[model samples]
Target chain A: MKPLYVIKIGGNVIDNSENLYHFLKDFTALDGYKILVHGGGKIATQISEQLGIEAKLVDGRRITDIETLRVVTMVYAGLINKNIVAQLQRFGTNAIGLTGADGNFIKAVKRPVKTIDYGFVGDLNNSSVNANNISNLMEAGFTPVFCALTHDGDGQMLNTNADTIASALAVALAKHYDTTLIYCFEKKGVLKDINDEDSLIREINPLRYEELKKEHIIHSGMLPKLDNAFTAIACGVKAVVIGKSDELGKLGNNEPFGTRLSKSNIS
Target chain B: MKPLYVIKIGGNVIDNSENLYHFLKDFTALDGYKILVHGGGKIATQISEQLGIEAKLVDGRRITDIETLRVVTMVYAGLINKNIVAQLQRFGTNAIGLTGADGNFIKAVKRPVKTIDYGFVGDLNNSSVNANNISNLMEAGFTPVFCALTHDGDGQMLNTNADTIASALAVALAKHYDTTLIYCFEKKGVLKDINDEDSLIREINPLRYEELKKEHIIHSGMLPKLDNAFTAIACGVKAVVIGKSDELGKLGNNEPFGTRLSKSNIS
Candidate 1:
């Protein structure tokens, strides 16, 4: 099977121009089919503040009210997504930016009113990802840059989590391609000591992941990310990586950098 | 050849919820391949006012500074375009929203500074449209909703005019389809008298168009729109119509609803 890289970049990378420039260069240099899933950064919050809209959060998850949804859609899909596509085009990568609604690439269900009413938020799973159309686009030689937004397949647009989207895409494309899902952020990898920059845990298996969690080495913030990584691995994604943005080229080459997640030990 | 309808809706229709809802319903009902091009309505101006971004208009044309370009990209591509696509999908139209930048379907050159420096404005002609990708997308069974924004083949996104985009798409697709370009606006048709809604000019051939202009019957804002219609007709489009938004279905059936621009007199 042909290899396809599905890379997800967080706010730390996208909010900084220098980091984005470096990461995009490495991304364009990586040969073969690739997809980029991007997260909304501080810009959305800043814009909301400017517009006098309040950002609500519950247990580290955003409550996407109508106004917040509008702000994120504009920032994520419009500003950041287009800017990235154009820059990739400049680098000779024929990139097309998309929200899940464009071409119905991804259909998600609006999060139901639970304990907290998360307005216009979407929850997606493997079935929600339109892998056929996306694979067709890759076959046609257009790299897709997806923003963190999805449609209910009826008429509503919903704000979604980028980490979950990356995992969903990776799992969906795993059948057609040997998929590698990489989560690029500010950290080098899952660190043994949070305060120590050089303490990188290179490779992790399902067993090690639990051990680390029980030891309290993997804290609250990295919990969701690690869960997504493990989920992608279990769903048949060949590999998953959580690493620093600057090390993307190394990840592309299958070199040892960042924390690599596997179902078991890759022995 | 299969027929293709290329419709351009101005700000008046988009700014009003009822008008847009009505127009979308009628548009989805139209048979055959179709493309919808929409202009940024007063919403952009409204947001600009709130953001304290000064909108500069010279000779009734917007002077797109960097900030204005950002606003239009957010509103047209992000908010309006996505909303329209999702709504159309609700009506079972299988709609896919696009900016010219999306698939690189349309490439425009930034307007060169002469007497006035129209900061990030784009100028597009026939060759600027990428009809091949569009035809392939239509063949894949998706109706395209285009917003008035384009990119330089390089890295810059430019603000483009929706009317010109509709004409360019019509002219480009004319080679593949029997194209009918419709410009739907607030008025019923090109009226012989501006005040008299009943004074509709039924059919307008090139000869009559010239005569009407020479006799001072056609004046003001309609002149540029007429120019685009004539240009489309000359470039091999089968027909062109300028009429009211609610009359979209009537125009599609060749019912002689609007000021139809044709090569010769259809008597």
Candidate 2:
């Protein structure tokens, strides 16, 4: 199978223009089939504030009301996504920016109203992604750039998590390619000590992952990401990397830049 | 050659939800290859007002300052474009929303300043449309839904006229397909009498169009549209149609819906 990379970038890279420029340059220079998944940054929140839509939160999780969704749809899918596509094109990458609604690439269901109504938020499952259509697009020579938005397969657009989208895409596309999912954030990797960047755990397999969890060395903030990485590895993705966005260039040269997780240590 | 429809709809169809829904359903019901170009409606202006970005006009024409450009990008490319794609997807159209930046499908030079600088507006020429790439996307089975936005090759998004985009696409794609360009607006067609709907000019060849102009029958508001339609006809578009959006379904059944323009009356 041909190698493919599914990379996700959060606010740390997107919020800063200089970082985004360097990140995109590295991204375009990397060889092979790749897809970019981007999360909404401070701009969405700032725009929401300007539009006079108060931020709603339940149990520390942000809510997506109708007005808030519109603002995000404009910022994420419209402003940020198109600008990124334009920049990629300037760098000679044939990029196509998309929301899940476009091409029906990912159809997510609205979260059910239980203890709280998430208000236009979408929750995905294994079958939520249209891998065949996405693969067809990549095979046609256009790189796909996805924003953190999905549709209900009805006429409604829903706010979604960018990280989850990246993992789902990797798992789905793994059937056709040697897929590696990379989550680029502010950290160097999963550090053994939270404050020490040099204490980066080079690699973790299922056994070592169990030990790390038992010892509670990973912080709460990193637990969900690690758990998701393991889930993706279990679903056939070749590897999952957690690292800093600035070090993307290192991957092309096979230098150690981040923590890599796979099914087994020997592999 | 295969038949392709390049359709443009303005504020009349987009500003109203009910009208938009019906129009999209009609659009999806039409057979053969089709592309939709949409204009930025009143919502952009509304959002601009809400954002406290004052609208600037020079010589009665709107100026696209940097702030205005951002708002329109959000509204057109992000909000309206994505919603239309989602709706079309719900109708099983397999639509992909796009701006000129996506796939480098269209590249425009920022309008040269002469009398007034239209800050971020884009102007297109014959070579602006990437015909082969667009054809490839269409041949790949994804219908394109474009908003009135284009990008300079250097990575700036620009405001563009949707009607011109539609005509440009029709002219460029004509080399590969038998293309018909349709403009859906508030009127039924180019009326012989401005106040009378019964005075529809069903067909207007070049000679008759010249006569209509000499006789002062065509109003100033209709002149630019007619000039563009004729230019498209001269450029080898199979035909151009001016009609009401609600009457779109009639075209699928070979029923007359709009005034048709062609090289000759017999065509």
Candidate 3:
């Protein structure tokens, strides 16, 4: 199977134009099939505030109300997604911006009203992804750029987590291709010391992950992300990388760009 | 060649929820390949007002300043486009919403500033439409739902006229498909008398069009639309239909739903 990269970029890179530009340049320079999953940046929140829509929270978790969903759909799927696609096009990448609703590529269920209604938030199930259609699109020479939005398959757009979208896509496409899921955030991978970049863990296999967790080195904030990464690996994704967005070019140079997570250290 | 419907819906249909829902259902029910081109609705203006972005007009013509461009990009390409795509998907049409930037599908040149600086407005030239790529996408079984947005190849998204985009697409795709361009608006069709619905001109050939202009039956507001329609007809589009969006279902029944323009009435 051909190697395919499923890269997810968070709001940190998207909020800064210079970082986005440099990251896109590096992304375009990489050869092979790739898919981009982008998170909603601060623009959505800013727009929501401007529109006088208050952020609803349920026990500290953000709630995606109708207004917030609309704003996110506009910012994530519209403004940022198209801008990235246009920039990629400028660099000779035939990029097509997408939401899960497009082509029914990802059909998600509205988060069930348990304890509290999540409003328009969608949670993915095993059958949510149409991997065959995505592979067909990539084979037809169109690189998909997805925003952090999915649909309920009943005429409603739903806000979804971008990291979950990336992992979902990576796991689904793993059957068709040797997939590597990369999560690009503010940090330079998982670190032994959160304050120190040089303390990057480099590589964390299942054994190392358990050891780190038992040692209390892996904190609560990074647990979910690591768990998600390991889950993807178990589901057939060849590897998962966590790193900073600006250092994307290092992947091409075969340099240790970030923390690589796999079943074992021996690849 | 396969028959294809290239339909353009103006703001009137889009602004009303009932009208848009019914129009989408009708659109989905139509047999054969179809593409939807939508105009920016009042929502853009509403959002612009909320964002405090003033409409910059020069000599009665709206100038698309960078601010206005951003708002429209958010509304048209993001909100309206995705909503339409999601709704269409619910109706079982695998609709993919798009701007010209996606897949480098439509490349436009920024409008040249002569008497007016249109800011980020894009003008479609002869080579603007990527017919082959569009045809390939359609053949792949995905319906293209377009918003009035294009890119200037150099990483800029330009505000484009939906009518122009529809006609340009029709003219270009005519080579690959038997294309019929439909413009859906508030009126029933081009009327002999503006006040009377009974005065609907059911058919207009070039000779009849000249007579209508000579008799002053076709008013200033309708001239550009008709000129565009006739130009498209001359450029190999099989026909052009102007009518109310709600009456779309009438077409399936072989009933006169709108004023049909062709080279001659005999067709």
Best TM-score among the predictions, by candidate number: 2
**Which digits, one per residue and each the tens of the lDDT, describe model 3 over residues B19-120?**
999999999989999999999989999999989889999999999998888899899989999999999999999999999999888999999999999899
Prediction 3 global C-alpha lDDT: 0.93
Rank candidates, DockQ, best first: 2, 3, 1
- Candidate that beats the other on TM-score, 1 or 2, i.e. the better one: 2
Best by lDDT: 2
B-chain TM-score, candidate 1: 0.95
Residue A192 accuracy (lDDT) in model 2: 95
DockQ of 3: 0.87
**Model 2 chain A: ten consecutive residues of lowest lDDT:** A258-267
Query: Once superposed on the true structure, which residue ranges of model 2 sit more than 4 Å away at CA?
Result: none
Model 3 Cα RMSD, Å? 1.4
Alpha carbon lDDT at A175, candidate 2: 98
**Candidate 3: tens digits of C-alpha lDDT, residues A112-133:** 9989888998999889999988
Candidate 1 local lDDT, B30-132, one digit each (tens): 9999999999999888877877889898888669999998888888888888888878877878787777877788889999989888999889965798898
- Clashes in model 2: which pairs? none
Model with the higher lDDT, candidate 1 or 2? 2
Off by over 4 Å in 3: none
Tell me how many residue pairs clash in candidate 1.
Answer: 0
TM-score of 2: 0.98
Q: Each model's DockQ?
A: 0.60, 0.91, 0.87
